[model samples]
Target: MMSRVAGLFRPKEAPVVEQEILSEKTAADKEANVISHSQNDNSSPSADKSPDTKWETEEILSDVQAGIQDVEALAKVWTRWSLIVAYITIWFIYFVDAMQQGMSTTLTPYVTSAFKSHSLTAATSIFSNLIGGLFKLPLAKVLDIWGRPQGFTAMMVCLTIGLAMMAACNNVETYAAGQVFYWVGYNGISYTISVFIADTSALKNRALMLAFAASPYIITVWISGPLADAFYHGPGFRWGFGSFAIITPAICTPLLALFYFNYRKARQMGLIPERKSDRTFLQSLKHYVIEFDAVGLLLITGGLALFLLPFSLYAQQPLGWKSPMLIAFFVVGGLLIMAFAGYEKFVAPKTFIPYELLMDRTVLGACVLAGVLFVSFYIWDSYFSSFLQVVNGLDITKSSYIMNIYSLGSCFWSIIVGVLIRTTGRFKWLALYFGVPVTILGVGLMAHFRQPDVNIGYIVMCQIFIAVAGGTLVICEQMAVMAATTHQYIAVVLAIESMFSNVGGAIGSTVAAAIWNGVFPKKLADHLPVELQGNVTSIVASLETQLSYPLGSATRVAIQKAYGDAQRIMIIASTVIQVLSIISVVAWRDIKVKDFKQVKGLVV
Candidate 1:
């Protein structure tokens, strides 16, 4: 196994055009020139650039760099063994994190079921996913300019608070808040780590490294299920959520220790620069406001929530689609989104997205691909575990393991794709020729097997089939975004990719909620196989009620059939949208990793 894994990550030179072969010195010179040009562009902006603005921007940059940027530079003096240890350290960090995530995933559906609002699961998910996605925009600037320590600190705090909130919550509103808080915090940490990987690794090694970093999923899937099962059945999910509040912060110690060690080393070597605050309170405020594009973030978040929430929720309105409340949501959301676009394109000093990257074909294509992939997944995935337990009569442990087949399979398969990528130094053809075909087959299979009376084994087969392509598409799209720019914009690039992915999840959640609520209730009346029916509203309201009857009993069978009917439509919709991802893949520039260092070479 080790030998095979070694072969997969053994990096090789990519084919290069003769004239494009850059000498080592020339490459260094080009990098230096690019840095210089960027510095000059900022230092000497248009005449409209204010004195206060210039001072605050540079001062903030210096302060942030002085605090943490030296840690990366300190690597120049590190031993090879130390670097290996650092890699192992982060891997362990993710291991602990995966345990927390596993516990949370297992508990989520029950939290809603406890409230008898299991069907409203996707409704809460819309906000959680929306906030999680929108939060990345500001975080990119924060991590990019403000450094990792602060980001990590914020992440730890949010996580601790969020977990505690979920643990002690008295009602669904608080549970929903817990869900939102937890997702936001998780997204922040994920963005930080991805940017760190991008910052430290070579482009050719990126997909391989990402897949390896994600390898904990293989083990975690097996363990997380039992841990969650033990907790849920033993002390209940409240205790499970509460345990992580303390455990996660404790697990984070080693990662922070590494940062501190690097910091002290840099300080000892005189690598740390001394700087002081030059901007006054207001000036500092304005500088950060513009840098983070706080206004734009607000507009987009409000816009997306207002606009998209209506689609999912319109069925709840008295008049359905014609409800005035729904109409207002649509209008307000559309206007805010439009206003956000205008702000970014014309009014804002620094656009919410970095202007140059926003224009890059690879970046744009990555955004679309990421968005579509997530949309397709979340549309049906929001209730999959619920489906397993309620429909198939699988235990939580069994259901959790079944769900993670996608993650476990993706982890291994992505490594192979990474190998192919590392060898050939290109990914477009892999995405087009392999990822697209498998996704179509998998999703098509899903639409077929996700019906009443179909064998449970066939559904598992569909997951494996989808997992075959899932890993490849995920790696390819992310690498496409990363390949477009230098480390300077790595965090922002990741933010862009994640933003799209999260937004897509939000869109998917909305659509899923619409289907589950709108279709399942309506179908309950028509799809019963027998006359042995119960309270329609009661069954629709809670999965617990749906499962109250014996497995083969009429109400239970009818509810399962109704879920099957709803899920079929959801999966078919997912299948239809997934084809759009092929267009995004085809639109990507097929740049080899060897040529990636040429700035703005995204067009190929």
Candidate 2:
């Protein structure tokens, strides 16, 4: 009692927080124990006959569980002041990174136009998104094996390299190349920070923590437009990109140093154990090659590239879909995808995929939900900025405000949704009945208001509506997936789950391109008078030509009609696919974050 009284007088770590972390570790161990027992009882005949089978998933899982335990144990050593400093640094990093994103995204069109390759926007988006998604799986393994600090460093390297490439690019191809590295880096950094937050926060409180991490969006939405405008007017887009290449690294260096220092301290204190392998150097290289499932990733990447790229390019080619090259791409891509599935299931000794988690209803459902939502959103959204500027006669600054208001709504409301989840400890009804419906309503509204001569206020309301739903879905679905898995595989789960969004976005972009290139030119010719029909090629190629004719003039009016006619087809398609989110939510087994026993694929 006297010692307790002294403890009360002294500055102490929050006991509730400490207790929660300790409890989470215990729960993770218990979940693993149950899985181990199940595997032991229901052993395969091949495994029972040969106990040395390398395919035993339990070994990999046990190692991951051990790492999580070590991380939890290490957290106890973090001084209260250090944790505060680290979190504040994280917040600051996100703030600056967000501003950088806002600057670059707002400037992308102008940069492309500067190179006279504005028409290649879809190709660039599809390629970068694919690179970003493909890297996450390998990067997840890197973080799981080496440490978060190392992963953060790799992320910074990619970011800097890509930014520098973009800043110095002399052609569209070089800019696209830079986009590959920068996108992967941007995604890697975002994922690493979130995983770091997950490493420290308790499961019950993680939603709120993650939601707060995204709070920079709320502020950046307002600032990014004006800032991008300033750079456009003052320094030009290249200088804007060039300055961030220098600035991002300078700001990120301090945080990177802090991460390494803490990681080293953890190692020296015996909180993290060094990995040991008996294989020789060459053998170890082979082991990692297998561990990373490099072959599987290559197959999938090849397949997706061959399969998906055709969607965007087929329309641009002379022969359209009938071209031999396009046919071969479709056939080879399909074959490669099929080969990937077979290899993962029957060939890879150690797959990166958490097959067990994928089997879980909640995980599969949430992933499908996210993928489908992106498919719908990107279909309409991929060309929206162009539409606003070309058809509605809006400037870049004003268009940014209208477009990014979604960010403001989603960011602000995510905090509210996070609080709701934490308070109630359930997400199914909120996700299914509320979030899905609101999202559909928003998408449906877009289908109506996106036409020519529609009031802009109606479109803004759609943004507000979708923004709130987006905030709701972001927190709700993430919680649903988290509650389904144990601590060990959270990073893997998140990375793979996010890959679905990328896949969906890629598909959406491809389809949007197909519609724009396939139908828009013909529609433009139809809308224009016979005398003006000769200008179709020029109008399609140049945003300036499209917008040069003042609003209400025959040319501008015809352009608006063509824009509405094409985008309406895209909007209707988006709305149709959104209903899939409901089905994804339905597939989730109701699990509560507050329930420790039900945390790992256990239904309440």
Candidate 3:
């Protein structure tokens, strides 16, 4: 209670008020005070209204007012530089973060191959992100109490060590352990950085800062493939992951030191308040952890694991859907989720995620739309390479180039959509108006794809269209989700969405991969001779060696025919996924713009 009273006197932390504007408001207040003082003096003139006393008070007031103006001028200078400094700092940190994520993709195929694993080992990537997402909530609370710079710096240190450990690993256990460390650190730091940007930036520049921060994600996704290839194929893959450990510290350390100095400087200037609270760390833990709904977290996590595990293990040689272990995983996971909703309704204080949010039209709609968009992205990213390989007859490097095209499309659209949303507040209609048709057209076109030679130009166009539509939905969802809730909950909401996206990607990849691999082989057999039908993998290996031959001639017609049929089947599955995404958008509620205001007990 005393802490709450202290906040009433604490100065607001933000961009300093302009000196001229400050002077005008102060002078107006002084004029009123002077008039009141004069009236009081007249009422009690006999008490003594000496000239010297009046002059002394006036001089003191003048000194204080001039001192305030000087302080204001200095504050303005710091504010401008702080924005620039922060942008550069976040940019550098985020660059390496994205680079690491991108580098992982290149490492996965090699890592699995080295270990002699039959599966794609993409689940390692999912598990890494899963660990990261799980840590985001705890990290969010930590940032609120410890301050952003300190929180960010601590997480970065873990990240650096984690990367170093992974680079030195020679076995799968050590490698997985190293991955856990890297992910835990990466998720915490990235999440805290996001909150810091939201807290420190102004309304005008918030979207721009967010867009710049997110740039590294797609940029690295595009660049990491070639960069990793260059390093891994030449020096070693270990060196590839190790490169991040060295480079990241160089990028992060200077920014962290600068942020610390600036934060201190701001606090002293009365731009940021010294937020001391009565509650102990133990109290905070109890309040957030013990008070939160554990059942909900368990249910959601279980549901996601059940839905994703099948895909993670699908492509393995000894795949089995009817095994006792698989049945146990699904049955128990399903029951736990069903019980989660019942717990939510009966539990007191509820979970960290309120049931109310699930019912909120805008918030719920955004989640559904996000799931669809995520599914599309999963299929595009996971299957596009296979498509290029089978239909376009491209090698790993060439197929990667085609996949990078989507990242380029995403990058350009992210910035464009950010600017558009900020300029036009009609974000709801912007999504529904644009999302519905482009999604339908793009997914519909993908369903009908055939051999690259038939119309390669058209295929690329359709992919780009889907990319734009998906990008638009991503930006709109960010706005809607943030706008729908209090700023204090924004970090939690984003983390939830991030978790869902991970789940969606896992499910989409599994389902799409299953469809393509399951149906395409049968289709391939229909046109090819019975002897050649069963040897699909060998046929593709043979086709690669025969790339110079006329793609349309009878000599390679069988291969082309097989590839075309497979491509069509995958596209058909994608269309069905896209339609489900559209249906999910129907539940989304429109959210309104809100200003940043302090919420008691929740300083974030």
Candidate 4:
């Protein structure tokens, strides 16, 4: 029994008559093994047993290596082509986005008039700004998990639906809801494009690629205002919203399809591992919920909304700052934020805002600088178009055009700065050397020359200076943040950067509203003669009412003067904020841009 068991475990051998043949075969097999193993020493031992085995193993190995090489080659081809397509698609999307934003800006007065409320304008602006910023957190996660094509598709769909809702809405509340959806989608798309660009381009060429992708903003900046004016005057505000609903989807479909094709091809070629979630539906859902950190998202969104809404609501509240609702919002919002901090620090499995990034001085400084810069910008920007039309006696088209000089400057200088950074691989010095003084000079000049009688030339030049400063700082700050962080943190850091900027914009809009609403009406009443005093309410209600008076009439002049005084206060405040922004620059550390290589082959 023992002998039989041992025999069962032993290998079978050929008979003695076949030994010579087997030796001949073994010799041939050995030769083949040597040739195959010379190319790849990692071959399995079973491959050397016979000629047939050797040929089969060698053939399998060659096929696999070739397949891997083919996959790698195909990945390169897809990456190269997809990058070019993505850039072009992003440029077009940006142009449309600019046009949409311009339409919103120009149509604000009309939307308010139709709704018969000026406060609604401020409220919608604040809501959209806040919501857009908050959405970035979840959107970032979505891009990481579901991939860019899905995220892009979601944004495009949201935008289209939002536009449709706006066009068909009959009430201010509905209109406001539509704006919320549209802005969230718009901001998400912008963020996604930025991340895509970062993923595709090398660190050395990133800034230039970003600038090139953003180049459409320059053309749209100059043309959007005029286009918006025509649409509003001819086809009406509904068309302004509805037209994009039709056009944007048409443009996005092909691009999305291209992305899907590339992504599928990559997976098929084994360039990317297959995403496997071998769980029940409910389990998968739970897994995603935890992965996305849904609790953290809700906490932050609730906190920011409650905290920021009061700024717009305070003016509408009869008791102003004394309102119980305002007090509750602040108190509750503060508690939620504290809770969020606690959760992220201890309870949450995954933190949305990485604590490690906060510890990095350069990243933190860039975020702070962005926040401050936007705060300064929006303090004046929130009410600038209305100010130009109502106070400075400029037409809607001309005012929009003039306001976009800032954008024009931003677009032009971004490209120039991008080229310079690519060449020098130096961004910190550029940010400090040029960004600070130019911004201060621009804001200071604006404060001094904000009067109705100031030359248009001087106003444009001041705007250009401020815009160029903004463009330069934006690029440099982005570069600084990228250099300071590792690949895994880049998307989150960028999201944080955008979040701070948008939050600052919301705060600035609120502050501007508080100042404008609190002081402008009172000042207009005081400046107007007794006969025109009753028109203060009307003048404040609509820019048209303010502009209806004869060009040089006393009523018009009073409105202009009142607006000028109020605007001066805002501009001066912005100048102070800009100075603070410059001071924030000191915290940034000089990191070599080229020494770091951004990780390649990220799908998003």
Q: Pick the candidate with the highest TM-score.
A: 2
The sequence of per-residue lDDT tens digits that candidate 4 reaches over residues 1-604 is 2332222111222100000011243576444221111112122224225322322322111222222222222333343335456566777888888888777777876777676666456667677777778678777777766666777888888888889988888877788888878988888888877877765555656788778767777888767778878887798889989999998888777678777687677566445554466899999988777877888878877887788778767766789899999999999989888988898888998887776776678888888888888888888887788877775667778998889888788878988998788778778888898987898899888887887777777888899899999899998888877777654456677888888888888878777877787778888888899988777777787766766798788988888888888888988888888866766678888765554444323121
Can you tell me which runs of candidate 2 are displaced by over 4 Å? 1-13, 17-62, 65-70, 274-279, 597-604
Rank order by TM-score, top first? 2, 1, 4, 3
User: After TM-score superposition, what is the CA distance of residue 282 in candidate 4 from its true location, in Å?
Assistant: 3.4
Q: Give stretches of model 1 more than 4 Å off.
A: 1-72, 528-534, 595-604
Candidate order by lDDT, decreasing, is 1, 2, 4, 3
Highest lDDT among the candidates is held by which one? 1
Can you tell me which runs of candidate 3 are displaced by over 4 Å? 1-78, 116-122, 129-135, 150-190, 202-205, 216-222, 266-288, 291-299, 311-319, 342-350, 395-397, 450-455, 520-570, 580-604
Off by over 4 Å in 4: 1-82, 601-604
Better of 2 and 3 by TM-score: 2
Residue-level lDDT tens digits of model 2 in 1-604: 2232122211332122222222334576655422222112122223233211211221122445444544554454555445555666777778888888877777776776766555566667787788788788888888877767778889988998988998899987898889888988888988888887776665666777777778888888878888888988997777777888888888788777776676677678655667677899999899789978999989988888789887777755789899999999999999999999999999989775777877788889998988887788788887787788876678888888888888889888988887787778788888888889999999898878988888888989999999999988878777777777666677788887778877787788788877777777789889998899898877776665776788888888888998899888988888999978988999998876665421221000
Residue 407 lDDT in candidate 3: 59
Question: Candidate 3 on 1-604: residue-level lDDT in tens?
Answer: 2332222221233222210111234576444221111111122212244322222222111232222222222233243444456566677688787777666654654564466431334445455545455555545545544555666777888888878887888865567667767877776777777666654443323455566677766666656777767876788778877988888878888777766675566456454434456889998766665443444666766665665556545434354675666667678767876777677667646464544655667777777776666666665455455456556766555656556655566656767776776566446776777866787687678656646566666777876887777667776776666666544456666666665565566566556556544554455556666665555554433323334346565435665666566556656666676776556566665433322221111011
Clashes per candidate (backbone, < 3 Å): 0, 0, 5, 0
The superposed Cα distance between candidate 3 and the true structure at residue 148, in angstroms, equals 3.1
lDDT of each: 0.76, 0.75, 0.57, 0.72
lDDT of 1: 0.76
